[model samples]
Target: MKQSRLPHRFGKERGRNKMDKFMDNPWFVRIVAMALALLLFLSIQDLGNKSEGSRPNGMESNEVETITAVPLEKYYDSENLVVTGMPDTIEVTIEGQRRFVEATKRQRDFTVYVDLSDLSIGNHRVPILYKDFSEKLKVKVEPVYVEVSIQEKVTQEFPVEPEFNNNILAEGFEAEQPIVEPNRVRITGGKETLEKISYVKASIDAKGLIEETIKRDTKVTVLDRDLNKLDVFVDPEYVTVTVPVNNPRKTVPIKIKQVGSPPDGTVIKRMEGDIEEVMIFGWTDNLQSVNEIEVEVDVSEVTKDVELDVPIKRPEGINKITPERVKVKIVTDKAKNAETNLSEVPIESKGLADSLDVEFLSPVDGAVSIKVVGNKDELKKAQEGDFEVFMNMQGLRVGDHEVNLEVKGPKDIKWELSTEKAKVRLKEKGTV
Candidate 1:
């Protein structure tokens, strides 16, 4: 290239002098290089700022909506996993790339696991592992290791064979002892899970088992499957079973036990009930001790009624009563009265010494009412004097007599005696 202009004498001298200075002081040359590099960096930064401004603000991860995944159950160490410590729920946090995290509908899609098998017996720290991430997305779990303590495996023996613990079947119905193909099962787990175990229940629920031979593979399970297993290592796997049921039918008799008396002036004549016997159906063991039959009636609130209800009652300690109800009828009747009239009747007194004198002061005719309780036939013939009515007159001479009389009677009779004041002339009778 042809030189367009001649070098100035000062420029040439300065350039030459600068080259010499750089060669003499290397540190000065390094400082100048750094200054140039900083200038270039600033220019590039400015260009980037202009480009981003042309686009839009908040277009990065902040622009998109964020969603997180939460687990339903808590994660715990396996072998030593304390059932109590194990959480019923777990959660997965997804952020940064909102589209990728929100699009994952299930927790399984983003593999989440705590390696329990690798855990030691004692307390341990475990890390949560995650992978496959781009620059735009991120997982929040930094220190993924979680602290957990492992426990020893425990085993327990439970009766695997099914049994009807003293339960009786109704007549013509029997339980076919279940034959569990594998009688006993081995269950191994943590202590917490083992402690919650209930009875391992296996059942053969078929009707009409009396005198019948049946072969079936009954389904069996641990009562608390979450805690225990069906232990079936005992004899008689697939329970080879037999049932001996009898068609049991029996008749029973019932009686009554009277307690308190009826109200005063009232008597219970007839007490009736709904039934005398009740029918019962149950296992022989349950029905063996049954003796009495009872029924309930609305007699508890009975005060005044010609006909009162009598409820049947079952005696205590009886297993079952046949003819569960019965009707009891108690017949009752009202009392009757007997009357007598005596006109100048003789008043003969007993237990009187011969030294005393006696006379009749009142008119002999007197009326009295006598009440008696008995069958209708007996009361009709009952009489007043037939019982006894008397007054003592030995101490007085002939005189006007006014006195009330008392009457005595047999056990079944009641009596009342009354008369108007008597006016009899007085006279001196011979003294003793």
Candidate 2:
């Protein structure tokens, strides 16, 4: 390389080096100078067309408007809203050119919703938010500072009643009075909404209620007087109605069943039992014809102590038992043979209610084989007049009945009678 004296440049080479440095700093030198020139020119010009003192871009001198917030009468509060009632739409006359008006009209109609929904229950003041507009623009409002009076919502409880349609109760069945478990419901809403509410109705789907006791869960529906459903709350979401229906009482004649057999050496002197009666209440078809009732006595392997336990029974058709267990005292003694006549004995009918008719069958006239165990002196002194057998037909209507004859004798004497089976026929007063 030729000797370079302190990096000296000349002619075309120097020009090329200078050009490269200028290109590197092109933005500052070119862009900045142009921007400054444009700014200076704009500053010198007036903001008006040459022909008139109006805006240069066909805009008015005053181009901005301020609109105030208008409150509303309601029980609710909201943050943002587009108000209604002034008109379906709002028209704005802008001072700007047609293009500006067209563009800003859409942008200018912005909403400043002062939510009354959340405000306190009393009157409140709220500010409206405006966007992209300067104080130069004038805002004309249909209604200003809308008198916003927020009323507090109220809650109330209403009773729900069942609505029955053409459904008829089943035959021999009647509609029971409808009783609601929780008759009332709580409704919470705005005061206006509460005022609009009319009544509450409980939905009763009788579609499945087939005439018997109808027990079901139903929903309580709040409705306006027009029967239109309303938005409300119920303290109890649902209510249950229990309807009790009554038909007729079914009577079943009770039958007596012997459970235990007497010991071999000792025989049953006289077996006696009263047929029990049971009245059942149920659906008509289920309780129609009750034939008899029977009771069961468990006397498994009972001997010597000789206490016989007997159970009275009603007809099998009757399912329920009025008297589950009745206490009966059975006496057992050594078998002895003695002849006794019914003539001298004071006939006794005990345990018979006043409404019964009694009759005597066997041992009424002739001598009966009286078997007993006691001191020889007591046996000798015992008279036929001291013993008696009577069958109760009192309160007994027309029917064929077999009653066990109860033998009444001196409590002090250890005597037993050997006749237990007695037959009696009873008829109604007028009937033969």
What are the lDDT scores of the predictions, listed in order?
Answer: 0.50, 0.53
TM values, all candidates: 0.37, 0.27
Best by TM-score: 1
Model 2 global lDDT (CA atoms, 0 to 1): 0.53
For candidate 1, write residues 32-139 as lDDT tens digits.
899999999999999999987675434755323323443433344534444223332344455554455556533334544455665556666666555444445555
RMSD of each: 16.2, 19.7
Per-residue C-alpha lDDT of model 2 across residues 294-396, encoded as one tens digit per residue:
5554433434444344544434333345555554444445544343333333334455544445444554542245565544445677776667655554455
Give the Cα RMSD of candidate 2: 19.7
